[model samples]
Target: EDKVVQSPLSLVVHEGDTVTLNCSYEVTNFRSLLWYKQEKKAPTFLFMLTSSGIEKKSGRLSSILDKKELFSILNITATQTGDSAIYLCAVRPGTASKLTFGTGTRLQVTL
Candidate 1:
């Protein structure tokens, strides 16, 4: 069975602090790894990594995939209190778009 694991299930930080979240997975015929930030009820898309060693970035958020290691990392820089949310990592295996999600990492950014 395919599986996804996230480390540091929860973290607390203050504004201006930087944080890194880790995710590891094992899947057959892996297609892509997706990152999402969940605030309130919906999870917003962050990044989708499909190639090894390539980093994807937007604003203060970035992510990279290490296919050789079967893992990925998400980095948030100068986090603000508004950045407080649950970070989710999911793996898409086979040809289907169906994703297997990790338990999630809850981040709390305070003043």
Candidate 2:
């Protein structure tokens, strides 16, 4: 069975604080790693990493994959209250076309 674990399941930070979120996985044949931000009912796609060591970035968010170590990290800089949301990590397999999601990390940004 494929599994994912996210560290610091809950976090609180003030505006302008930089935070790093972690995700580790154990799977049979890893195809890709995906990050998402969930605010409302729908979750927004953040990034999808296929190759190891390559970093994906957008705005104040960035993520890097590590296939050898079976892990990934997400960084958010200059955080604001708008950044408060649940960060989700998912893993896809090379064989099956399904996604296995982690418990997710909840971030709270204060003024």
Candidate 3:
């Protein structure tokens, strides 16, 4: 069975703080790693990492994939209350278009 694990299931940080979220997986026919943020509504895509070493970035958020290690990490800098949300890590395995998601890491930024 495919398995994905995320660390620090919950976190509380002050505004302007930086955070790092982790995702590790073991599966067959590994394809890609994806990041998403969920609030009260549907989750929004953040990044899709397929190559190792190369980093994907957008504003204060960035993510990188390490195919050799079978894991990925998401970094958020200068976090704000608006950044507080459930961060999801998903992996696309094999030829299936479906994604397997982690339990997610909930972040709360306090002022």
| Model 3: per-residue Cα lDDT over 32-59, one tens digit each | 8899999999999999988999999999
Task: Kindly report which residue stretches of model 3 are placed more than 4 angstroms away from their true locations once superposed.
Answer: none
Ten contiguous residues minimizing lDDT sum, candidate 3: 1-10
On TM-score, the candidate that comes out on top is: 2
lDDT tens readout by residue for model 1, 1-111? 889999889999989999999999999899999999999999999999999999999999999999999999999999999999999999999767799999999999999
Worst 10 residues of 2 by lDDT: 25-34
Residue-wise C-alpha lDDT for candidate 2, range 1-111, written one tens digit per residue: 999999889999999999999999998888999999999779899999999988999999999999999999999999999999999999999999899999999999999
Look at candidate 1 and tell me the lDDT of residue 87: 99
lDDT of 2 at 97: 88
Which residue runs does candidate 1 get wrong by more than 4 Å? none
Mark the regions of model 2 whose C-alpha exceeds 4 Å error after superposition.
Answer: none
Given candidate 2, what's the lDDT at residue 92? 96
